[model samples]
Target chain A: MHSESSPLGEFDLIQRFFKAGADAMRSNDQKMIALGIGDDCALLKPAAGEEIAITSDMLVAGRHFFMNANPELLGRKALAVNLSDLAAMGAKPIGFTLSIALPKVDAAWLEAFSKGLFAIANQYSCPLIGGDTTAGPLTISITAFGSIPSGKAIRRSGAKVGDDIWASGIVGDARLALAALRHEMNLPESDLKQIEHRMHNPTPRVELGMKIREVASAALDISDGLLGDLQHILNQSQVSAEVFLDRLPKSETLQKQSEDIQNQFAASGGDDYEICFTAPIDKRDAIDQISTALNLPLTRIGSVTKTAGVLEKLSLLNKNGVLLDETKSAALLKSFDHFVK
Target chain B: MHSESSPLGEFDLIQRFFKAGADAMRSNDQKMIALGIGDDCALLKPAAGEEIAITSDMLVAGRHFFMNANPELLGRKALAVNLSDLAAMGAKPIGFTLSIALPKVDAAWLEAFSKGLFAIANQYSCPLIGGDTTAGPLTISITAFGSIPSGKAIRRSGAKVGDDIWASGIVGDARLALAALRHEMNLPESDLKQIEHRMHNPTPRVELGMKIREVASAALDISDGLLGDLQHILNQSQVSAEVFLDRLPKSETLQKQSEDIQNQFAASGGDDYEICFTAPIDKRDAIDQISTALNLPLTRIGSVTKTAGVLEKLSLLNKNGVLLDETKSAALLKSFDHFVK
Candidate 1:
């Protein structure tokens, strides 16, 4: 994999691999990118009345992904995860910057990685702008930029009491795939094949997020498990939540698993990339319209409640509508934490 | 140092270290950062007619710094390097995001690191908006955002054949410090103290860059050696350069070194973070006025030349005003390349 006579130097590597990838991935809707990768800094001209939304995510080999993970999938997943953050804020995709550290410059690996990065970037109209390429342990950090109308961004602190908590698409399939990958569970090859896409290439709900901007009271994407991420809303909004397990959405592949597996994974599974949100109960019809218009499921699984203290932030209920004991609920599933891991 | 018990977890770590750092570093002039720290995405609302300039830089532990280096200086230098990129474009300080990968969490180290980061951030009025933290090899990647007038950014492709080449402040001091650290040379304690700050903490020359925008036809920050980085301007502008060896600026400490050492390090040393620019002969008076107003020295070092082909892209001249022979000139200095190193 190491070539002593490689013609590409550091700058040449960026211009050839990254600059060319960005040029090919340029989308017509992304007029905000006034300049791309060739200068000291890229210029972005946001529209007159719009505000820019920015978010960054970093994925390190052996920590965020398997050391033997495919370069193409890793590239796509890195950008996809950051896009999910923008989607949760109801921002329109504009562009993104990628900082990657590679152990070595393997031409074939870079070719596949750039192909995957541009594929998803073009699909979402998020053009590649500027970034840094360095030599180190394999790590990918992407900062995605988007635009939204001023004061219209969905924030975590906007959830009000009695608001309906909603989640987009299904959760837990990605967690299930991870379980299979870890050899913690034995699954049929067909089931693994069915759910692998959720783990490798989960879609960012950009359009759905934009459509529900005026309807959703508060929002955030599920990355560190549904419960843990939702706690961000509870903490910020100073509210409590009671989630009904019977109402939690799941894929048919996930439903085939045992009840214990379904409940646990669906509740605390990370990497869902699905937007968990809340809205006033009266806006249910408007929310349904967005669901039909975008052709994406928007499932209501709980209600926001006024909180007097932090101890009552979350309540978990079983399928029969009975609140589960705190100890049993807490023992069901474990969320991933970087420090702890 | 690794500790058995860490006081902060994932979310609390961000809240205590990063978010609090940003809050303390907030400046009044940086109103463009409408939202910061706690959110799915940070919101930035650029003025109606302004454009955003973005750049990112990454530093690996062993490659960019000593393994036992100070964390505080590392934090400051990480953001300083990105600010230097914006300075090259004559853009105003706005905000930045930091993505860090660490093997373990050390509370005292984090506290000092954040203090250093905020000290420089507040000094430049650049607030911290959003970023990601993950567990991996120690690495810092910072992406800085700045605002510029529409169509007014200094670009490398704008240099003309007769443009005067200029550089701000002194050069070679950082490389001298590096040499001392590598045990390649020994210097007095006073000399080391004078140059150590240049190597570890470089000022971005933000105000000077902004002041000389209209006068400078082309500009860039000297990070990868003066000659190599000037090659970027030459290649982009399709012009050659003739730099006088005697005209290169050096501090009193640097001048105390041997002539060979002085020439080699000043010409090819990296991490200068000083602005190198080209301006028309007619703008000389204006440039001098800017130097006086900003209290920063701007020295003339060379002139751009019309080049017929890439082979003669740069020419080095001695104090006698005669072009040096190619072999002798080429053997004098070497620039750092990560892949090669």
Candidate 2:
């Protein structure tokens, strides 16, 4: 039934691109997955006491990523971005579905893409449960599932006043990568590689998020730049934040860029795939312990204030130990909204 | 951002063609749906004690359906087809994700499509949780999730010899509809309307499937015609069957068509969306009671047999008390592989 002249149809594309990445037989512990992939519908056993976390995201060609970008990285990033949401909620990754529309079924591209997706799924212990394939412009939409205990599931609206704000990993590197991809700036090959890696292969921080769920009051994944993402938490938590620009974890490569570029990257860059969370000051010691044990960077960049505005300039101090144009810094953050819309 | 001169951009197209259909606010039952549509990633809470059934299917223009067809029905059918997989497993509908790709965002098409999707979703009580939208050839991919009790999933491999074979509703209507749509046949307005309805709004039979889960030893939904779908059950169950051609349901319109056209339609016609199941003879009484209660047609077309060969004909005595060619009469049911390729 397979034919080269046929141009690799949807069924073959599914077998080559999607079926390989799915790990439906990891552990026999899941009696609910009676029938997994390679079937019309998967059979799952809904165990008592666990709530399912479902999330989906679509990555479009050009709009979401460059068409010339590596297919494997694109696939990995597609799944990774969705996994970040599960991480924010402190849920354990279980399985996910991929719906892909492609211009044509290229075997080499499919091989690499599936490898990238499976790499992350294997690392996170999630299986490729079920999905659909079709023909169109290259687009990948992934719907991921996770399991969490009832009532313990974290929400974005749980932050309280007087809470300490924390962010995982450095931000802005991804934005710098995007700039580099657009050829707006030229940098050393090593630096370019670093920035590209940051943009393409973001770690979802699943472990750190799961650990923090017990103590963190509220959490959300950073996707649409730190400023915008943090604003969501603040809005949901009904509190204000004082973010320290000086405390912002900027990559060395970003710092080496022009000062204006660095500021823009720091303020408005998206695709960080990090976790921004809030917890009461009382849990500071536990937070530190978690950071130390996981050996992952956790930076305390600000505090949740009782006021109703998200102010970042208040935390930036000039080299002379005097506050610089705080209003200017705030303006930079506010300008990100334009790019997002 | 809404520009007709430049054509609808990908983002605007997404907002119109995809996001407008999202009815995320209707259901609060799934606590795990922390973040519904309109976000980078949707947050969900998996309920305790139920495992998730995840599946995805993609439909492409000029491949799955005609582009000139009603967008609303296309949108609804895209989702309904996926939901049918869940029903086959006795899973309860929960939520779904829609990833749509279009050449351009036409506001009118989007409105109609969204109305179609939300209308069906409301009837089935499934919420549009999250998905991605992009620019490309017209294609829709839906990843749907449902919950089923652990270890209670019905599968295709559970049928035993001597089991009674049953089919729900009428078959060949969809194929007949397709033929009419393609102008293969001419019929009265009433028949044309019925055929078009069958073609456009193929119901998934979720309720009947759920009800049959208790008594059905094995089951499958007929998407790829009756014979091909039933073959799957036989292949999985490692059993064969004798089918009575006289018992096969046929609409008056189908009967009016030439015998060859009727046979081909019955054999290779796709989009039946009916349930074909096998059960022990002891459960026949209970099955009839359930069928009567549901006010649905339940045809006892045949019985499972230890013999292992395809029987297109059954030697039942006719009114003249002579043997007839049941195989020739039943030749309309063929494997889906013949037509899809």
Top DockQ hit: 1
lDDT (tens digit, per residue) of candidate 1 on B243-281: 998888999999999998898888888899999999999
- Each prediction's whole-model lDDT (CA): 0.87, 0.73
TM-score of chain B of 1: 0.95
Docking quality band of candidate 1, CAPRI definitions: medium
Measured by TM-score, the strongest candidate is: 1
Q: Cα miss at B90, model 2 (Å)?
A: 1.9
Kindly report which residue stretches of model 2 are placed more than 4 angstroms away from their true locations once superposed.
Answer: A1-24, A28-34, A308-341, B1-49, B101-107, B133-138, B184-190, B244-246, B307-341
Q: Candidate 1: TM-score?
A: 0.96
Chain B alone, TM-score, model 2: 0.87
What is the clash count of model 2?
25
Give per-model TM-scores: 0.96, 0.85
lDDT of 2: 0.73
